[model samples]
Target: MKDSLLWDLSDIATNETFPQLIADTKKRIDKIVTWRKHLSPQMEKKQFVKMLNEIEDLKSVIACIYDYPALKELTDRTDIKAREMKATALDIVIAAEESVRFIDHWLQGKDVVGPEKLNDEQAEVLFSIVPEHKHLLWRSRELALHTLSDVEERIILQKDLQLSEPLLDLRRIIESEQQYKIKLDGEKKTKVIRTQAELSKLTTDANPKNRESAYRVLFKEYEKNLDKYFIIYQAIAKDWSSVANLRGYNEPISMRNRANDLPDELIDLLYSVCSENLGIFHNFFELKANLLKIPKLRRFDLYAPLKDSDKTKYSFAEALDLVIDTFEGFDKDFADKAKRVVAEGHIDSHPSPKKAPGAFCATIHPKITPYVFLNFTGKTRDVFTLAHELGHAVHSLYSSVNPYSGQNPTLPLAETASTFAELLLFDRMMQLVDTETQQKLLMERLADSYATIMRQINFSMFEKEAFALFAKGTNPEDVSSRYYQNLLAHFGDSVDVDQIFSYEWAYIPHFVNSPFYVYAYAFGELLALSLFAMYKDSGEVAVNKLKKILTFGRTAYPIEMLQELDISLQDRDFWMHGFSVINNWQKNVQNIFSHERI
Candidate 1:
């Protein structure tokens, strides 16, 4: 039977079918090309505005048209039609971008400058007409050194689609479609699981043996296919490094840093602070081990539930109510925006065969109420994931006032609302539990923090080294050895790191799909934690501050926007504030244990 919580996709289709949409997209691209041919650097302000508007319209149309097929593929990877349609949609987007490439190249030329930086002659030109596009123009000028000619850029995009993209698709297919088998306690027969999401839940199973079995099953599968995984990853890394080199980026991660509009110093500081604070998590692991009444923790036991942990299985409906009510407690608008996702049938709320692992909220355009994908399994973490994805939906809705170009925040700030929502949910969950369960909840929150903040940083650090090694033509075994060393460094002596855990990196999709994307989690969590502290102290004022930050979207530099709220990203102290919160929680767990012993 289809679950009641299953999302309704009837609203996804429009009057035009996929074929018609593709045809319309082609016509749109051709129109843009014709429009571009008629453009001139010496054009009037009105003409410039018209050209910008046309490009913006094309972008919006592409986003709206591509969302359905892309979403369908995530829901069911086996749907060959969806896959084809998505590729077609992507190709059309690339074609449209290729056609309009000259606009940016022209803007980056001497004829155009930022509003503040414009000369008398430049002021007379069309670029000074739109103040809103000043940042876009200024940014182009700043990156003019790396901005290739339209032809070169086109070649790179085409090569990425033809070469790098297929490798990514192959990795996804292999990782997502593989089946995992494990025998549970008291079961003579083995069980087969289709999706990694199903298998992952067992990693936190209350039973220690079940957790061990789950890890063994997961790593064994990856170990068997290590060579293929290595080839795919190595190729992707090489491609990424080559492109970075071609673009004159100092390092592979510098490309991502530039795209995120953050400085290399800032990222280096973030990573340095995180690496220095490794002992915090090491202490946390020891605390967790003591709580579990074990001598030491295995990597598999990192998320293991405590003996007295709340094992209450929440229904989907129940989880939805908890999340909604939690949001409502903070602000009615936030709650309503989150509820809109559910009301519009935008949430796919259950796990199924071939469904993608993990949860995400897809914002197609400002007008669309983002669709959320989930593999809910009634665990407490599942409830938090519900809140997390809904939080992303609310953030998108809040930023709807922005043009398509400015609607999405850069990767680091993107997690602010989502992580803050988890904080709200965590606080509410605390209120509903007894003191003992509250301690358990605190422990779980710590585990989540370790996963969200430290683990992601670890991934980012590994990527930095892995990318460098691959560029030097490092072997797969050496790469795996490097990854294992990273694991050992991350866990230290507080937890046991096994050989099979080296295969764990292959299981991470972000490394394949978007390199260096994991660090954003750490950045967002730390930022959100600091903001949440302000909320606890100032209440409605802090809420309004967050709402304002969400609305800023990509309108200003993230650092400037944050500075407007008295949040500074310039120093190590700001990052330390977040770790301090985690440290206090660890101390509280110790206090709870101390009190019990007396």
Candidate 2:
């Protein structure tokens, strides 16, 4: 595929045929409803298997019907018909879920109080009939503990349908519509960049003035619409808090912890380990300043390229080949799987004025090769993003042995392959460059480490405080002030953070899209660091172990699946070891800078 090329949509239904696809999905849903009506704990194993098959079939169809329009809407935000179709698809899925709510209620023994109903133990006994799906069924029982009564569940679903959709859509619409103008380093004329991805390129522009101007341009729009964005965010927070409270979670983040099937204590440990390691990043910033020959580093200079850094740019095809080659160095099977996404024409490889800003991999179903969406600008980082997203696709492909119910991973484990992909590419690039270029690569790696680990942890910290403040009837301005304080604590004396940076919180889509989702990036990056260390030491053996974990998919909890690698979720030293790997890299960069003057 060429740069800025749209993916082939023929594999998915066209607008002319999409309505029929939804109609067919509804018919399957009706069939599943009939099957659910007859479901019982005491049913024969053969009958139970048949019901499972029907449910999986319905889910497969629903995935396609829903994803078709959703993918279209992401690529072209101005596609009104795509938006409406996505809404219709969502409503149908919600109704289908409501119609089959009896399954969970019956499994939890909530549908009836008498002896005929099944409790957790009895449900597990029935679930044992399908050995491959036992964990999925058990997970359902765990979630049912937090499930509300049938009436309350329906009300919440209806409320979400009415309130959540438009709020999220508003954010997407505003972001896609915003534009920025910046003067090139050597040119007097200004360039108009319409997408966030394009604007992000200027933040790392070689000229310091252009770098600062990019930040100003980026935050200015957010500051202008501060009130509107805050209102939307505040409502989203309250809505999430209300639902989490009704479900009996102790705190806002606790709900996310439970959804990931992780213990709250584990997340707490991650926070503690990262907070204690703040000095590592602090020293790295000083090292960065030394290499740049600057007295101090500013927040806007976090991602600034080294003064003599290599400025080589890759074409779309070159980037793809590099990623595939990097994966092939680990395992040819991995390289082939990454190529399948492209061969199937499942990647949208460029930016557009109306396209979504960031990158993501959407796995519609286990049988389908995942579709990747990117705003490729041909920078080296964009090459890593290509590897990152294709890593997600490889993860999905590896887990194809599972049924639909077991195909999706929890948030914490979801970043494993993607982060590992970037590291593999980093390793490959490091081997091909000279000493100075190696130093530059190390700097880029450290910058990414800071972004993925410290930055994300700080975002989660702000979220924890923001949610508490929002619950106390605090306004947006107060929350903004608290966020600024949070940033101060994060940077400490290492970097200068400006007040305009406080508006940065509103610019992050995760806070509005997925609350508490930032921690997963930290979780994944640390976990990947540890995994990369293993791969470096043991080679193919470690590679096989990593594959085993991915193959498990949602078949087991993250902690359980990670046992294949002997990883412990509750061990403080385990998390600390990941930080140590980063510390070592920073030390190497420091050593390199000490030996030479830029």
Candidate 3:
């Protein structure tokens, strides 16, 4: 399995097909519900413990049933069966919301015996068996304050799921149906630029004309279906707002921040720091434009390569070796865990027309190894992506000792390993490349940094504006206009903003799927940059600190976890320090250019 690049779902369920698996899951869910019905808050301590075990088992089964179909649909968006199965499974899981609420309610009740009440010996025994379960218990109690009544919760769950289906379907429609015909190198080519992954590569095409054509075509498709996409966006935004309001959240983003166990103030600080440092990226864009021999960068040329016809490419096998070796250099355990992902056939790394664009690492349950999905195109960036997603896999593996609920870090911390992996890969490339190629790599790294950090920060800004406008019942055109203005601010005068690119916001799935989620990338990249700086300064000690943080999973709050390394999320200066690192890289690029001019 380690030798294979494709994911083998057999480990999840081999005897049954997907349909059979769904049926089996339903039966198991019913049994759990039936068992749950027999229990009450008045139950004995022994019975309470038994119920806790039952809930854990139920969570594991639910995760197992949900993940395979979801992964299937993501791997091939055109698979109707996979989509249907995933939708059905999600509906079942939503229907079982009562069970979850019921357990949480019971756990929160005064009649339930808690760990503090137990004798020290008894507490020790429980801790030995489920050391992390105490955190889950505590979390449940915290959520209990926010939990709606079972009936109300079910209605909201159903409504959210129902609203989500169309968005998912719309995503499939866009990915599978969108096409753009353009002329390149005196040849007319028809490209099905559906996925962001494909459009991302196309945006960096060596030819400026090709890059412009790709951006125009990409946005034009969204513009063509503007009304439909707008309605979808409106529905999703309204639904999210209504839910957040009902949950007593101050705003839509507040709900997301709470879910990630982060303070709204911390995110605010992040955005504020980034917004203040926009000049750094503006300088980068201007430098890039100068390097490209253009007076000003068009939005399309934002990702344009500094050099024409860059020959850097890596085969999938070669990419695997490069990422594995990079990880090994950083930490042997990191490399070994990354290799296990490929070895266990937990990666889907083929390029196909219908395959979903982008890459992700999905960890279904702590007991099951994580799976990675990639649209590997053999590009040098693809190698970094390979490392990024595999970094997520390794993070999951490290936290496998946790229960399913405790295994995953919050969204910001979740990117810690993935972004760290990219940094390691960048350093490795620097060490191995000639001076000319090294400069190219540095330019590419700068571009990536801007993309991941400032770009995401700008997206967060757009979301804030868009959501505010949505609350006012702003029209789609008005929303698009606002988005265009956001882009103008993001690029400043360093790049030319096209009208068509205003329609660009219409295609960003995160705005529809996960509102206010973009900031996590900004949060993560900066955090990783800081952590990498620590690694450079402190070496193995920093590495050990990171390993400890990853292993803690959700047991500790992310802010508290970082404090172990003397990093403070609330410190504006700390975030500003990350920008300083970027500024240093910008200086390095300028130095290289000046030396070349000589």
On lDDT, the candidate that comes out on top is 2
Q: Tens digits of per-residue lDDT for model 1 on 1-598?
A: 2334666655655435767767877887887777655555466667778878878878877886678877787878898887777777777877887777766666666332222233335634554677666666677777877777666787897898799989988988888767899999878999998877789899989999999999999989988888889899988888888888898999989999989989888999999989998898898888878878889998878888777667879888888888899999999999999988888888898888888777998887777778899999998889999999999999999988887787889999999899999999998987888888888788888888888889999999999988888877787688889999999988889999888888887888898889998898899999898888778878999999899999877777888888998878886787887888788888887788778841
Query: Higher-lDDT candidate among 1 and 3?
Result: 1
How well is each residue in 1-598 modelled by candidate 2, as lDDT tens digits?
5555577765767899988888887787777767654666678889888887777877887888788998998989999999899989888887678656766577666764333667666677778889888898877877877899878887887787678978999888887888887776678898888988778888888777888889988898888888888998999999999889989999989898898888888898899999999999999898887777788889888888888776778899999989998998999998999999999989999898898888999988888889999989888889989999999999999988899888878878889999999989988988887878788888888888989898999999899998888888887678889989998899999999888888898899999899998899899899888888878878999999889888988999988888657878778777877787788888887888778865
Q: TM-score of each candidate?
A: 0.88, 0.90, 0.87
Candidate 3 lDDT at 463 equals 85
Best by TM-score: 2
Q: lDDT by residue for model 3 over 395-426, one digit each (tens)? A: 99999888777899988889989999998998
Per-candidate Cα lDDT values, in order, are 0.83, 0.85, 0.78
Q: Please give the range of 10 consecutive residues that has the lowest summed lDDT in model 2.
A: 107-116
Q: Please state the error at residue 460 of candidate 2 in Å.
A: 0.6
| Lowest lDDT 10-residue stretch of candidate 3 | 110-119
When sorted by TM-score, best at the front, the candidate numbers are: 2, 1, 3
